[model samples]
Target: MTPSTSTNLTRIVKFGKKPAKRDARNLKLSAILKAPPRLPAEYDFDVQHNGIPTPMFGNDYHGDCVIAGRAHQTLRFEDAEQKKILPITETDVLKEWHLENGGTEDGVYVLDSIKLWRTKGWKAAGKVYKIKAFAEIDRKNHDEVKSTVYADIGTGLGFSLPDSAMTEFNAGKPWALTTKPPNKKNGHYVYVPGYTKIGPVCVTWGRKQQMNWAFFDKYCDEAYAMIDAADTKKKKSILDGKKIDEFLTKLKK
Candidate 1:
């Protein structure tokens, strides 16, 4: 479905395949295993902004996911209807606007650049302005009845949903709980999208460590190589779970 944007809305977001894949990679998996997991992992990017990294949406043109925070602060009211706000009807057109202004025409936050506009002072004018959004990994709570039986069957403990799964998981679906958009299970975040069920399967009975270790074992060589060969200190930080969260959180803010 297309996104419906009104004066009250701030961002537009959607999920779909892209002819060109995003560049997300799983260096952790590649490090131990010889093979490199798919580039862009499972998510696409297509956010419209000046210099910000947006999702690279596919030709399908699915509606964009409206970023729901500060983007709304920039809404413009129509002169004809003071009580009602204008809606951005076209994703492409809205994207165009997002590129020009710091925000999307639909009001999605798409800043061209992030800079500390102010160097000092205590006034609002001295403060820097930037938009930040973040998604914490969480899993759906399973029934106690099933948990006991499948305690080892599913050890839901992962930082975030594979980027591929975030779209459907984020949609207003039965599984995507309203209170927790990404849902949480145990200590890990879980989002069981339709796509996660496909591609590959392996039998295992270990706990979370076992699962991650097994998965990474298959592509350890590639994952480690990416880490070792990383030229910049910035890239190396991705390997550290804490650093990844810090980076993502900073971007969201």
Candidate 2:
């Protein structure tokens, strides 16, 4: 029996893979792992923008939060008027980049993942997975570029959560995170498509999770604003010819 198109449409997301490495910068972010990070009280504002509609994906057994977040950014950007926002296959993230060391059940790396995007691109879901890639969305400081980037491009925000692993574990929602995961083992990452009634709506595990304005303000340490390639004139790739080795050297301490 042939699988219905609708059944295939729901297969965009998969279980998350664990984080690959723990870097000094990430550890620093994790050190301040108190629940409900302190922030200004009056700043109870929420903002939202456009994004692709991806479903709640699970890592199942692997720790691939990095890939999951990247998938969110990639799929949402690629989501054109298709029935599904992110129409892709599991092999895209799982199998394609084996020889180049593109993926791992252990985890995904920020710079390494960039290399994968540059080298192999990504697999688009259809009758068969199609090769597709997007222009690099320059990594800019949220404070410096947030004004220009937010509500514009769907991007990635890297931050560490408090002791809310259990919260995330049960609810399948991740909010207030950092590049350096707070737990010391997991460097959690999420896709920030846009804001909500009170705060930014984060994407993970098929859920468009929204966090409190204060929580987002305090834990959001590092942010990378991503725009669809066609949306901005920044056509040139930011990570041109850069090697992941350089980032690895810095991550290891």
Candidate 3:
């Protein structure tokens, strides 16, 4: 496929809802449909380093292959009393699931307890994980409430695609139009195709913490010493679990 050829992209549209045994399961379904006519041209850069080029339909420069645009998506769910909309990133979704299902609640939710047990009479191959957390204020019996649930399965965190997903993405991975504005937390910035100053959000992880030596050797040492000289001095958790209190106490001597 050439960059100029038109390609089809799927979109989900919710029509109605269906019955489910669980109240949460009784949710709406979205039908995957073809996008509307007169869509914007999609454009992605083909520049690559030493890695092998990703799979593509045709020449990398075709407008038909590119679907460059902005998208603003909002996720809504009922929280006992009212609808709650949480704007989250792809990573935030995983964190949210862990918060909702795991014993250790996130900043928003507080963990109550967790139980783990085997099902078989003897040596069972799998174990069950059960967890409970504090309910929202609007939930029934909010002050005195408890829920027991189980997931009879194996759960683990794994990694794939050794290289960056951005590399694959820029190599003409067909995507949807996004209206989300770029934020500084995304790390890097780039101007949009038509919108002169509008930039997109992009971030990467797995980096080591580095200190600012020049600034560290400046105004901080004296003030730090004075603070450490106090009677109620306590250790601080620094990089890689190093403590500052012990070091400071020794320095004061």
Candidate 4:
């Protein structure tokens, strides 16, 4: 298959993820989930439920992909672990985006968004949701990316997208590595809840989008594994067996 030929389709969708940021205080995934079990060749937590619809969360009209990614991940996590979907609305996402971007359409840094997610939390369905913690993942490490999805830790990804991606997305095709260079100015964010033999699948623009491993390696610049507070409360969480409680305690020191 050839790359999309439409160079003028850059504005087809809104990309709200700002350039990647490095924070020294961020925890490493390896340090938290040590000696992770071998992962299955394929795993997916973004299973379609009977009535749930994949939401765009205001991403279509606003540059809130970062905030939208958070909502998508929350939906996937709650559906898989709690067996119930939280009513996260577009208004909730736009509200958070307004707070993060200072009431502007300007994008937000991935690290800053996750930090707020942990400390302040996002409000949805009359309930406030917060993550226990978030760990930085090596974007280039395919195994680590797959393992994170396999463990039910929803992965948030930031990418320096190539212009051709817009055309591919418009055509409902999986994102693939192209000879075209990545545009750093076009940073976007998405939530990855599963992986197939072809590669990791992400939710963006209110739909399930697939990307091959090469596309992921070429474009993904920042990655994170979020530990949901609700999952921690349920002892059945895969993380419960990993002794995350002890790890978090040590982190507080």
Best by lDDT: 4
Q: At residue 245, give the lDDT of candidate 4.
A: 66
Clash counts for all predictions: 46, 28, 16, 0
Which scores higher on TM-score, 2 or 4? 4
RMSD of 3: 24.5
Candidate models: Cα lDDT each: 0.21, 0.43, 0.16, 0.79
**Per-residue CA lDDT of candidate 1, range 33-111, in tens?**
2222233222111111112211222111322222111112111111111333323233433343344334522222111
Per-residue lDDT of 224 in model 3? 5
Clash pairs detected, candidate 4:
none
In model 3, the runs with Cα more than 4 Å from the true position are 1-31, 43-97, 104-159, 163-253
Clashes of 1: 46
Write candidate 3's Cα lDDT for 50-153 as tens digits.
12112221112211111000000111111111233222233332333333334222111111111111111111112111111111111121111011000101
Query: After superposing candidate 4, which stretches have Cα over 4 Å from the reference?
Result: 1-11, 48-51, 229-253
Arrange candidates by lDDT, highest first: which order?
4, 2, 1, 3
Relative to the true structure, candidate 4 reaches a TM of 0.87
Report how far off residue 71 is in candidate 4 (Å).
0.5
RMSD of each: 18.3, 10.9, 24.5, 4.5
lDDT of 4: 0.79
Residue-level lDDT for 49 in candidate 3: 13
